[model samples]
Target: MDNEEVKLLLVKYITGEATVQELEQVKQWISAHPENEQYFAQLYETWHNMLYLQPAVVNKDNAFNKLSADIEPKQPSRYARLITWGKAAAAIALLTAVTATLYTRYSKNVESVRQIAANPGAIKKIVLSDGTQVWLNAGSKLNYTADFGKTTRTVYLEGEAFFDIAPGKKTVPFIVNTKNYTIRDIGTKFNLKAYATDPFFETTVVKGEVSVEGNIDNNVHEMSRIYVKPRQVLRIYYHPKKESYSYTAPDTKNLNEIQVSEIDSAKLDRYDGWKENLLVFDGTTLSDIAKVLERRYNVTINMTDAELSSIRYSGSFKNIPSIEKVLAIIKANTAINYSVSGNTVNITRNNNND
Candidate 1:
């Protein structure tokens, strides 16, 4: 209640003589205010250090003299307890110093870094501690701090992932960090792709809103941030020359660009089907298709023919048959011949049929 009452409670607590009611009251007092917690922690540390001190080193009369002179009546009310402890106040100071050293060493052992990696050809589903659902695509990885969803919710991404972020405490926003940019969610559902080898980073929003921010000059002034609505797609193309640009298109080639465009909500599966173990290609080029198949099936598709690589194909297949079967279906759709030997498949234009 008051400073003297709190000091007596602290003494009882340190000596393990506190009743249940007194313990709960102290806990409530400490939690009610940040400064209260800090004050109690300092006294707690000092009391803890006194436990380990040798009896011979304790000079009760000298400690009493020092404490009497050190504490002034006009100081903070909490410090008045030092005079009340009398000779014990000197031991508390010594113990407080020892506690600081121990606390520093203990803090070093606390690791907050955490990571989850998805294997190639298999999707991994994860639910964060905050009830956020994530479908990590094949050959992808996600890392976050252990303190995630506490003060803030942030995760680093490599490759692709579909996030269905739950509405968390409104004070703390959820963020997905990529190599080039960051996507901040406001109770949203979105698909993010940032494969290391791919020249572009992409985000497709299914519902709600998300902000994508990019840094071109690596400074606050040069950063670009944009918001995407539902049924819209944002693509950020990275240039080797470090040039910055933006456009609005359904698709883009290798260039220095950031594009955002509207897409049909019915066609959302075309972008998010991989999370359901289905592969969909909508007029996707053979070269790009090859990379997708390689990541999805964990196989090598070699197509050295320049003409064959440029062919566009559109198809959707569920996870019923093998990748070889999928390739066979593609080969039948196009006039392409494939020779498979073990894990490698070589594709060439069907010259004989043509």
Candidate 2:
């Protein structure tokens, strides 16, 4: 079936209104591809969260119409309209929640806010209301409010994204907020990587420049702002216990450090190649590389030996080669052997550590 039909069936299935045939169709579609299953899981999580939300005074007809217009301009099917309001109330609420979360009028005058997510092994490209283009990497999320370009243009990010920001009228200043730092654009193109699970946060500028400021004790450290030029990379090594780096914290002096380095054209390509479906590893340890492989291929990789996991290798794979091929390449370069069972790959050290 077409995408719209599948989506409608998924909604029906979530609301307990799908017929047996429709249910089987959804199962078949989900089983057909790994991405489908991931989509369903995300959808189900949103629906589940809506259950705990207090019911707001939402105009049902207006909400439904807005949802339909946003999702698809075409008319919804009769079956979609016939769904019992009692059964579809949660779904409708979910749609409303996803579209915008209402805030008090005094708070930034924000009318609506939205979030976009890219599941593991998927990359998504989106254009903001302000005309800025963003490419979200696998397992990343971006959040912005309705009044995006009115007074200030800012986006909250988790994970990685490549941004080509559109210059605003009167120079409103585009800003990206992460867990540890805030990057202010100087009318530039840049890449930001700040995954929560990662020990380091990095930003690489491709064109123009950006100012990187650390967030300290929930405040922006204006004094710590660092201007980064094109071809320069700013990397911050931080620990979870101390979320941010402080200029005065002696205890964290060793735990947190900032480094700015100049990179060659080849290194710049390696940083931005994920947007082109390229996986590049430059002297990355096997353990760390496995994390990237897992997100890119949606598989579990287990290294049986600690020393094997610490082995560092560098290589590049374009167009997303299969997990087996990637592992084979690694095997050829290192003294390692691996076996795949279903979606899991187990790695063990060879007889010699050469």
Candidate 3:
């Protein structure tokens, strides 16, 4: 079903107005995919929160009396039951409008967003309304509003994506917002990797120039906007704030650090080879590599050895080979061994390591 139809069904389901068939349909949809379940859970939470904020105040005694009077003579007919359902639906619609109004009044720079997601083990390519092309990697999500190119050209990213922004609109800049940084394109094509689970964030410019700035709310300060040219990569190492004993004055000194380095023009594939269905890992840690492997193969990788997990490896695979072959190659070179149980791979230190 389309998003709107699914949303309507979900609304009815949440309001306890859905028929048995409708409830079963919603259940099937939610169980179809992990994203569907997540979306439904989020919507459910939002509905409850909104209800809490603006309680639907109804005179219980008066409503009960009216309901009794309406059905006092005999059982209500089909038409009467439908009329009651319609009134309840109208009341829900009004409540939704009031919640939206309250949200708009309290929130800043809020807009209805359209989210696009790429599930694990899959890649998706999409063209924006303004001709900008975007390639979303596995386990990634991109969110933007309807007024994309007309009023503002901005999108929020929660994973990795390669953007080839369409030129000619000099007045409106294309902005990509991540959790820790904001990347503003300067008529360029770039690859941005900012997975929330990853310890580092990276942006590699393939052509033209782009500027990167740290998000102030993330406690990253004193760094001005840094411009990255073609074949240049910008990496940010995240340093999470630690809990302190003294609550009076918390230390916010250790913010995320940024580093910029130039890459060989010929080695652009090391950054964006995934677009061509190539898996490239350059000095990537085992733990980080497991994350990528998990997304690529749709499997769970558990690293039992901390020291083994920190071992860095460099390799490349073309045409998306099997997970077993990839792990076999790593085992041959490294001091680690792995066992597969169903969809889970358990990695541990090899006792015969030299």
In the range 122-143, model 1's lDDT, one tens digit per residue, is 8999999999999999999887
TM-score of 1: 0.63
lDDT of 2 by residue, 24-46 (tens): 88788767654345435444433
Deviation of model 2 at 158, angstroms:
0.4
Candidate 3 stretches greater than 4 Å from native? 1-111, 216-223, 241-253
Candidate 3: tens digits of C-alpha lDDT, residues 1-354: 654456567666644456667878888886765434543543443433222221234343443343333223232232222212244444334334433433432222232456798998889999999889999999998887656776567777878999999984554678887754668874679999987776677999999899875432243333335788999998877564356322222122344566789998778898898888888888988987998899888899988777977899998889856789899988888888899988899999998986
In model 2, which residue pairs have backbone atoms overlapping below 3 Å? none
Clashes per candidate (backbone, < 3 Å): 0, 0, 0
Q: 224 in model 1: Cα distance from truth in Å?
A: 0.5
lDDT of each: 0.68, 0.67, 0.68
**TM-scores of the candidates in the order shown:** 0.63, 0.63, 0.65
- Report lDDT (Cα) of residue 66, candidate 1: 35
Model 1 spans with C-alpha error above 4 angstroms: 1-111, 216-223, 240-255
lDDT for predicted candidate 2 compared with the true structure: 0.67
